[model samples]
Target: MASFLDIIKRHLALSIWAFSIIAGILLSQTSIDFRAGVSRLAMNSLYLPFTSFSRTYHLLRDRRVENLRLKEELTTSKLRVEALKEAQRENERLRRLIGFSEKIEYSNLLAEVIGRGTPRMPGSLVVGAGSDRGVIVGLPVIDENGLVGKVIAVNDRSCVIQPLNDPNFKISAIDARSRINGIVSSNSRGKIIMENVPADADIRRGDAVLSSGLGGLFPEGLLIGRVGRVSVPQSGLFMTVEIDPAALLDRLEEVFILFVGIAGEGESGVEPPEAQ
Candidate 1:
């Protein structure tokens, strides 16, 4: 039951054999070297086609291997580029942090933000410095931008900071333009707002809000945020004002622990910061 293709293959093989023998005989008539003439004929008619096929296959395989190697090298280069970019960005951040620390008059301890708040201390962050580094509760924490929070709890290795966004965190803020007074606190939803503003207060949107140094907790003139919105209460003596925090609290990486005697600094052996 040979198919058409099988029958053709058999005939083709026989024709090849006949052609090789005839070509050898004709070449052998004129050529003085009989073995060399037959060998040349067999090489041209039989071995050359197979050799050409093998060479093409090897070339294609080598090209594929080279392409894979190039792809691997390209991927490695991309990863290295990304790592370098990250390093450059980190370097810039540290430079800015150092510059801010130098400009401030207070003696500050540099601290790294290690972790976010836990369940026991919502809306807070853990700093790498603790009592061992002269960090104590009530020390104000700040970043390159401005005031961040105050240290609330400390252990041997770390301390927790109650960020401005915390529900219980509050500071006396004032309008830098007009010296109008108000209290800055975060709402239950973590939105920062200025409370207890007089109804006819000169405070307005775009005013710079700063710590007034009234509560004896935070130092004066530290930036709190810019006033965003101002509203009047229907039946109250004060206006409702919202202020944006100066520091990017959610992305905090490092901060300075201001060593001013805020509160509860006794028994900690920390030196008082010089007045500005």
Candidate 2:
């Protein structure tokens, strides 16, 4: 699996956006049906191996989780206490998922994660839901842990997500404890950070960060991550804030896409490209 991942990282780093533009331009005169056929073939060729790997990884993960649950059932009193704590945490997560669903003005649709993109686009994820299921570009995608990414490209059968960790991604965020606001984005090296924060702000390690919904692009109060490190720059007025994402993004097997969008912003996302 390590070698496989290395191969993908080394050889499959080209962005889909680049592919779309090039295909669209070169095949501008092609019939729509013809282009669609080519797009499907290309998408399958590019992503099928990754999909199989993702499923295998998740199967092992599920087995580990099941083993932990079984072991808890046979444990001593102290271990039983740990089991209870774990149950409570799970209950809280369920309650949070319910609350999140209700708070949204639009409906949610669950979709399976099929693949990942890397190298030039490390944060790209491909999901097995698309236009046929009413998914479009700019829809917010989340899992129980919170915001994961947004739908960026879609066809009849699948779509690609650009997660929060992507270098091209940014959102308005606030410290839940301090109520101080900043823009959350990835730095040059792909680490998530909350920028434009005041040097003297009341942020601390472990402070919960959430989407502020100030820009109207993303909904409010979704957990982005927890604050990690706080440091002041030598010659800058604002401090640097590192953040840890709320979700195990690399392990995501499913996600929920909200049907809401800023009308024209999504526009059915970019359609799969035509072939020459």
Candidate 3:
């Protein structure tokens, strides 16, 4: 019984002493070169696996961050491309307007579209220029395509334009092909109706319509619209004609108001000035 326990306690101190002696003999080498080689080999063996794992983890983290950064840059580039396209379209529109304005014979006031009229009445717009820009009632407003409307009301900074689709708007126009005269007016149905055309008139579809200078409001030769459908009822003496206005009113964003110059003559066939 004292046999097994006493034997282990006696051997434990001896085991520790033997280990220390062997370690001291290895550390106290005869040559410094031998010791340096052993230390290098031990350190490499101990740290190689840990160092490799650390490098792999950092590489993965950096790759993830770079992917996120690339995605954000791609999104921003798409937005910038869209913005550039919109700007190009606007520039083209302005260029066309400038060329159109140069050929007209009246003093012009350029106005930016501020607001649109109620959607229920499509074709009308509010402009930023009004009396302050010399815009007055009955002034003809036109875009690059053709006549858009006339000024119906004016304030200091803004005015309301009555589009050609309005019932109160009328322009004397002539068929460019046949030279037949008629009045282009809008009905309550939002259709432009050409009146005063004779039943036997030779007007046809696709005939260009131009302002006839019959009214003192619109300038002569300004494009008005094109004749669409021409009908002659059995008992009717006048032809029923439909016209499509030349202006793209629904997409209008800018307009030029025509001011009657002091030296500009009144529209052809207008009455002379009355005595004051």
Residues forming the 10-long window of minimal summed lDDT in candidate 1: 267-276
Model 1 TM-score is 0.77
| lDDT by residue for model 2 (1-276), tens | 999667667766464566678987889988899989988998699878788888899999999999998787767767878999999986786676677667655567767889898455666999998888877788788887878988888888898999989988988999999999999999988789999999888999999999887766677788999999889877777999999999788888778787654544432332222320
Better of 1 and 3 by TM-score: 1
- Models 1 onward score TM values of 0.77, 0.58, 0.74
lDDT by residue (213-257, candidate 3, tens digit) is: 775567778888888888997887898999988888888888988
- What's the ranking of the predictions by TM-score, best on top? 1, 3, 2
Compared with the true structure, the alpha-carbon lDDT of candidate 2 equals 0.82
Predicted structure 2, TM vs. truth: 0.58
Candidate number with the higher TM-score (2 or 3): 3
Q: Assess each prediction's global lDDT (C-alpha) against the native.
A: 0.86, 0.82, 0.81
Please give the lDDT score at residue 255 for candidate 3: 90
> What is candidate 1's CA lDDT for residue 224?
95
Q: Compared with the true structure, what per-residue lDDT tens digits does model 1 show for residues 103-209?
A: 97878888899999879986789989877877778888888888898999999889999999999999998899999988899987778999988998998789999
- Count of residue pairs whose backbone atoms collide, per candidate: 0, 0, 0
